[model samples]
Target chain A: MAATKDPRPCSIADALALVGEKYSLLVLREVCLGNGRFDQLVRNIGAPRDILATRLRRLVDAGILTKRAYSERPQRFEYRPTQAGLELEPVLMTLMAWGDRHLRKDDDRPMVIEHVCGNELAPVVTCRACGDPVRHEDLAAHPQVSGWTVSGPSAA
Target chain B: MAATKDPRPCSIADALALVGEKYSLLVLREVCLGNGRFDQLVRNIGAPRDILATRLRRLVDAGILTKRAYSERPQRFEYRPTQAGLELEPVLMTLMAWGDRHLRKDDDRPMVIEHVCGNELAPVVTCRACGDPVRHEDLAAHPQVSGWTVSGPSAA
Candidate 1:
């Protein structure tokens, strides 16, 4: 593993960098779903014990998760998402929707997301400018920055 | 490092399992912005060379990005986002908006995103059922399965 570099001081980057790891989202999803115990996360995600521990610690360090002592006998702790972590629910839902649409083996029956409104949900993006729902073709490249201006093997 | 375990069979889990790693979103962001070469990614992100290579390969495998050979003499390759990858631009834009609102330093201003209509862009989520805009608090939770329930841990 490479040394964890200090993240590019941007919230989106920080948020993604923090919860962007393979196990982090799983851990967060479980916690959001009300599963917070070490054993519960391990059972729910089937991630390794050490990896779960490290991810939980990282989440706690980032303030996305908080750990509370659950028992003293074995010094057990349960992880819970903070408000910041709950904010990621939308992002997770979008990712879930993408996966269901493109990667699911059975395209007809993908994972279901129910809105609090008693409605089954599908991920949707809308334009803030026009209050119009944005379809794929609705978006065109803004020329202020041309593709080639930022294009190159060495510009990243 | 811990062994990679098979995540849940759900699409959400599968998607998260794929692009949920560190620098993955950053890599995707760069690709969406049209930075395609390995050296450009390295220059933009400052991620380790090996890690960048691995991520580029993963993106290509996921169909979010495609690699094209641009030069035979230097044996150079460039990455471009496929339609699937372009669909994620809204998500990335939303993430950027969230970051700009919550994460920017006092002195630094993030780049502005404007629609082709010359309107400033902001992230907005829409309700698929009624085609109405949905606010964060307006969402109501409805569980499809008996075992799956929504509850706030803080409430408990």
Candidate 2:
């Protein structure tokens, strides 16, 4: 089936639509972590050949990734992130942290991501207005009439 | 075609696979903003009717969102985020900030999101290790052979 046209109300939706498949984010994450070969992504992601090919093509089309012919002998190709793709690192990290926290068991750490500064990484969300970290209780939504009409909950 | 299997190497991939369709994130975003009704999502998202129905069903199946019959006359339904869905707010906010920064023109602000304290909002990412805001330069990936193998430029 043809992919749906991206709904652009929010950039998150646009980004997700572009890379929201089962293997897409993993492919991007692999690329972000420096994996670029088609074989490497297939191996790491453990996806079927056709599915991997489609996801890679879509990433390249979206400017999140680019492929270069590495060798003509075996028809080899390598993938790399474009600037747009690199910008997605934070999002990837945030998702990783969420998954680790919510899904993974306490004893079994899936993978460890660290900074160059020799510190174990944690994902943090900061408030733009006060420049302080935002907790769940710290943020609330202000609704416009359009927002209110659509939303079922009263503004907190 | 059958949907691709969930790529298990990363949690982000899992999350995206579950609710990563064209209108899924947008619908989730609207729900985060308190917009829940069927007509409201249709107005906000502009997605196809069948696709929207499918996406909603998938989200409900995955426990990210729940559907309730809000009205009887026209058989209206309202979508609400479960805790799982509410947990996605940060991810959505992060994507919105990225879009505003990269996609919007300098003169055209698409929309303003305000925090409960009546402050205009901007989203920020910080390092979990140092308690300092993370910049592009602060992150680095170590080449571990066991994880996804990377073959691109060191950073991108």
Candidate 3:
């Protein structure tokens, strides 16, 4: 059987299609971190100004962010996370935790998130129903597409 | 501080620097899903062959994946996740869950993950110290870099 010609219609794929562009999530990082002004994003993300503008526009169009006027004289605007964008914070946290574990020394971590629980935040993905930390081996995927399986496209 | 001339060094930024390319995470997605061969990846990810090859090489070089000879006669190789790569599964799961909640109808989700605990997996990010599901408002960011705050660079 040939592998399916199309990528599986997946929400992960969909999410990536929206936010996977270079510098896009970094833009989210800046905004979510409360640095949302254009100049601040340009400085904090190191994305070229034009590219940063484009990303901000795309995010706003996708409803992940909103722009609000923050200055009156020059009409300066700032970005803010919409609900959808705020919810992605965990994804960013997990990614950061991974990088902290594998790429940085504990003392070299660039920033730390302190959860309201009073400890430095280490994000863990858990099963909502079971409250157990998720592990790769303990999960089984069921492709909801017509002709695909967890392994690949089903034989025609 | 004039917006601090440098982007705040961040592990999230470091992680994004490594896997922030267009198809890198999707490549990881396929490998994690057990479709690790070249043809399988090509079919499953729909990335151009050459681009996919570059991504595979980069992933292997980054130690997120390993290339192992799977067939001797034709010298075929398959990719497998390293420990670091498996740790990224939660990020993917969370991204998928976000997309499912925001972008797709419940019945329209293209896949479901079944946790070993006999429930459909709904990945939730929780605080490791407190076991509470993380919320945007409940977290605080502390920028470790000098002259930076959650809002922006401090005035020098």
Candidate 4:
């Protein structure tokens, strides 16, 4: 990791602050898949119970999820995704796609996605303006809102 | 996180296994931003020296980055992204967008992306099948390849 003299804000850092922990997004993933109960999350996520609780509270605080009562007698709560949480579907999808492409030995994708019509699907990221598949070559990143200086290995 | 009774493959888990740690992606971010030297990465990422070294080696082993001899006098090397590393541009872009939208205070976005035409851009993830933004409602995730039971909050 390189040190930057400029203390400009970095979005990657902010996003990581939200979900970069090893098990944070996994918790959210479980919630996204509708496993909102604490016990269910504990079993599936394989994270410590306390850590799971903390991540849940953090996600709620981050406005990505909301907690609602599912049972009154036991005071059980079910976590649900807010609009912001739902927006993370793409990030999860892309992560899954990358994993499917690079990591798995067998076609044993843990979760298989499909449409009601029984059509298997893969999602792609594209440009809103051009409707073209977004690629590294097609875009350049500026560290700040302005002043586009070329950096990275490609520049070499 | 939900426990899966069925031991199917999970791409997200696989991907997370590679880069889900708190500082792993940060290291990658610094590298992606062209801060490949050890001292540069350490300063910018604020990660421990040993951890950064370990991550750089792991990234090299993962085929995401390659090490090249940059200087012979002192035996210095530069880390460069391979094809796989470059493919992560979209992921970084999306992360930046999320941060800018939800995390930043004064719009100090770490990375600003622009098209060749100088049009500021936000990458959108969509499905290739329908040319539509793949939202949670548009699809369903099955625990297994054969079984297609809908199990998510949106199902209700």
Q: Is the docking of candidate 3 incorrect, acceptable, medium or high quality?
A: medium
Q: Write the per-residue lDDT of candidate 1 for residues A1-156, one digit (tens) a residue.
A: 423343233445755766677688888877876778887788668888999889998989988889998789989888887777776666666777777777766654434655656677765777777876554344433323222234322322
Q: Which candidate do you rate higher for lDDT, 2 or 3?
A: 3
Candidate 1 runs further than 4 Å off: A1-11, A68-77, A108-110, A134-156, B1-7, B71-75, B105-107, B131-156
Give lDDT tens digits, candidate 3, residues A9-38: 788889998999988988888888889899
Which candidate gets the maximum lDDT versus the true structure? 3
Which lDDT tens digits does candidate 1 get at residues B18-131?
677777777877776667778777866778999999988898998989998879988998888787887776677767665655455562534555565557676577667866
Count the clashes in each prediction. Answer: 10, 4, 2, 16
Q: Which portions of model 3 show Cα errors greater than 4 Å?
A: A1-4, A152-156, B1-3, B152-156
Task: Order the candidate numbers by lDDT, best to worst.
Answer: 3, 4, 2, 1
TM-score for model 2? 0.77
After aligning candidate 1 to the native by TM-score, how far in Å is the CA of B116 from where it should be?
2.7
Q: List each candidate's DockQ score.
A: 0.38, 0.37, 0.64, 0.58
Residue pairs of candidate 1 with colliding backbone atoms: A20-B20, A116-B140, A116-B141, A153-B39, A153-B40, A154-B40, A155-B40, A156-B40, A156-B43, A156-B44
